[model samples]
Target chain A: MSETTILRTEQLKKSYEKGKYILNNFTFSIQKGEVVVIVGPSGCGKSTFLRCLNLLEPIDSGSIYLEEQLISAKDKNASKIREKIGMVFQSYDLFPHKTILDNLLLAPVKVQKRNKKEVEQEAEELNKKKIELDLEFRKEEFLSKTTIWWPETKGCNR
Target chain B: MRDMGISVLFQGNNFVRLLIGLLASLRIAAIAMALSVVFGVLVGMMMRSKHGWIRFLCRCYLEVVRIMPQLVLLFLVYFGAAKHLGIDMSGEVAAILVFTFWGAAEMGDLVRSSLISIPKHQYDSGYALGLTKWQVTVHIIIPQTVKRLLPSGVNLLTRMIKTTSLVVLIGVVEVVKVGKQIIDASRYTVPTSALWVYGAIFLLYFIICYPFSKLATSLERHRKEESV
Candidate 1:
């Protein structure tokens, strides 16, 4: 019930078939800027829980709220709600046809309808930061041959 | 040399008649291809519908089209349907309708297979990026689908162009029909003309289809290289 609560689920229940609930009476809440991880053994409802949260899987019972707004309502536009939430899978699911920069800019430009120039600039900045971070990591880890790595990272980093 | 049947090519207005017939065939194939692509993309998307009944219906259409020969489908549309419906349909219209129906099913299957071939993680990532299903489809899924479908789509188009000779069976004066007419006219005057006339028809078809087949192969090769 805290004012900072960004996501909340109340007695949510989900089941593929009759009688067996994969996610039964699960109630949880996350505060603003909080990083919440659901860790459990394989076959436990961890993935199902994330899928339900993203509205990829419909739940049998209960409700989910994002920013105190009822998002799991049947009539709610799931895609519009999804626009405010970003999920990253364990597997890097980048679009193979698109370049790394294009993969980063696609959602922002196409889905969010943000200005392509602005999104591209933001993506460029993010890419620079990533390269810088990688370069730093490489420098620290492999101090022997900085020259060999410079040419590879220079194209993007510079 | 003057008595040879190959003189049909040099015969007055006969060449023009063949050209007109070739144009007609091209027009039909072009119109059918455009309509087929539009309908095919829509039906293909529908085939992936979450509803069981909808998917079943699309599957049934796909199977029926695949199972029945194109010539039979042409007869059903031109002769059978027109007769039962009490409507008069022109040979050209019937040919277009038949080709469109056949092409749409082929294109739909292409779209469906290419869509399913896309990595599952791509959808997951699209959704995770806060994209709605529609957005994910438009921005992420469709672009990939189009890329994957292009080579096969080009190949389907060549197949359509080749199969369009069947339209001549229904009395549409396409290239093959014109060739037969030329041969019949010259049969007595130049008995050797049949070989040359039919050979010309073969060359015309080869000209139309060969480039497309090459394009499809190259596109497929490019796709393979990119995947690697």
Candidate 2:
């Protein structure tokens, strides 16, 4: 199936030191609406790959393309690139100072610059929808973006 | 029959005088602390600057404040600056300046450490939700940092209060200075007045600082419980 590739990487390499590559010559690609699971042993570069894809960690030698735009360049704005990708961390990184309702509306109202009233309304609807569906999903579902699942199946970390 | 130096406080208005002196100390500490907490947050934010030069400059400033004694700073601001540099500042003002500078450095370090204590994933989570860098810092990072900063910040305030005693050396006429005056006045009558006078001053300091120490502990415990 010739699906449109949403994310693509070519020869992605990450190293902690010289001649020691954690992610060595790793080539990966995922199409829009596609879900890919990466399984590996401890310290086998699985987390490194996800972090590199999200632009959290710099790649040593490789190129990353998000919808054909080169994101792994030296001059690319990391924060700007990161905005388009959602990463569910192994630990559900909830802002402890804010309430659950405020947490839901925070990014939409502040980051996206959407109307607070509108965003709150949307969040209210989403909260109701989740309840109606009776789906016991974790809070990570609200933190929408890239889907990187870990071992615990919810909040997995090493 | 009456206690040696303890009687001095009740002889006339010595106790009230000491209270007023304490208020003066607190007054300077309060103003300095308020300003330091403001500037300290800025300094702390700058400590995280991507530019090596900025971090180095902040580090130097922090080290300078940390290394030099507060008394030296007071002399520099009060005697040296006032005499040579032609800066007309009162003892109180000088004390405030010295304490503020020192407190800012201390609070700045506290802020930096608290900011660092936050897990990396908090920023990642914010960015992943399409938050800009500024938004991530303001919404995600800062709130958590504030929670972590509070306990230490309160402890800093208590230290600021205790350190205000040093202002007496620069002739600020604060609590310790008043204690000295009381001891000096009744030197012949209460030969051991220094012991009692200083003891009361110590009691006053303990009264003010103990609650803050408890508060810091409670805040830290509350944070630990919540974060877990």
Candidate 3:
């Protein structure tokens, strides 16, 4: 089976001020169900690139396509396009006023207008399974704990 | 019995007059504050408008109110408007109009600054969650802005209450005006009537304003604790 390209950006260009491009001629394509990591030094446009993908920051010039649809066009609905993309921030920006469950269900329930009861049930089941796995991993790690002799600590002056 | 300055408050119908006057002040302040807050929030939202002309217009209004004295504004509305524009505005109406204008400007500035102070990440996060701009503003931005706006709003209310004394100068017989009346009436009979009457007026203002000041302080402290 051939892999499908989910997202494709062509000759992307973005600048804060005139003639100063943060994302100059950037081009990339991501396949469906494939993990792509963006790594770069400080001041690089990693975050800006991600923001531009969702139209959080407007690109100066480029074409971004989600599958076959041209999403970066002027009249394209950014909010609807953003609904299909899920992003996790380095610093968790969860709504402080909402509970963890509500935070998880907010977009699905409110934006997608999904059935609340169904989403809630699924989320609860997922949370329970995650907690169970975490506990089992902790137990295994504890059971496999071993003591290592430190010859250097004993020989060195205290 | 000549130096009955403060004691004139207890004189015949003087106490009742002062109470009525204070009630009048409270009534005007309450109505003006409510209108100010409603109009102020609208103006504040306008100040953050994407349109440069809208922002410029709002900024001009804000600067005029903030730079000019409240007394001057009161005079402008009461004397200038009535004389030049041929509008028959009562003293109370003029006072309410001027204060609303002034208070709205102050409140608008407060709302603008508080809304601006919220981190950019909040909007980004809300957008990333697929919330529309209006939905993000209504659900996420407004709640936080309200929390931050409370202390300053309370402070502005208190300031408006205190500033209501300026209405007396415009011939509105509010608390200070009544106090002046009492002093004038007792000037010949009582030697220190002015002191007592003015002291009572001062106490009336302090009584009205002190609680609001305390409320503002507590609100600010509570916000700090929550943030920490």
Per-residue lDDT over A65-146 for candidate 2, one digit per residue giving the tens place of the 0 to 100 score: 9888999999998767766775666766666788867766675576557798876776666555565344445554644321
TM-score of each model, paired residue for residue: 0.86, 0.79, 0.86
lDDT of 2 by residue, B86-113 (tens): 9888999998988899999999999999
RMSD of 2: 4.7
Q: How well is each residue in B161-189 modelled by candidate 3, as lDDT tens digits? A: 98999999899989999988888888788
lDDT, residue B41, model 2? 94
Which candidate, 1 or 2, has the higher TM-score?
1
Clashing pairs in 3: B5-B192, B5-B196, B6-B196
lDDT (C-alpha, whole model) for all candidates = 0.81, 0.81, 0.81
Q: What is residue B13's positional error in candidate 3, in angstroms?
A: 3.7
- Model 1, DockQ value? 0.52
> Which regions of candidate 1 are displaced past 4 Å?
A135-158
Interface RMSD of each: 1.8, 1.9, 0.9
DockQ of each: 0.52, 0.52, 0.54
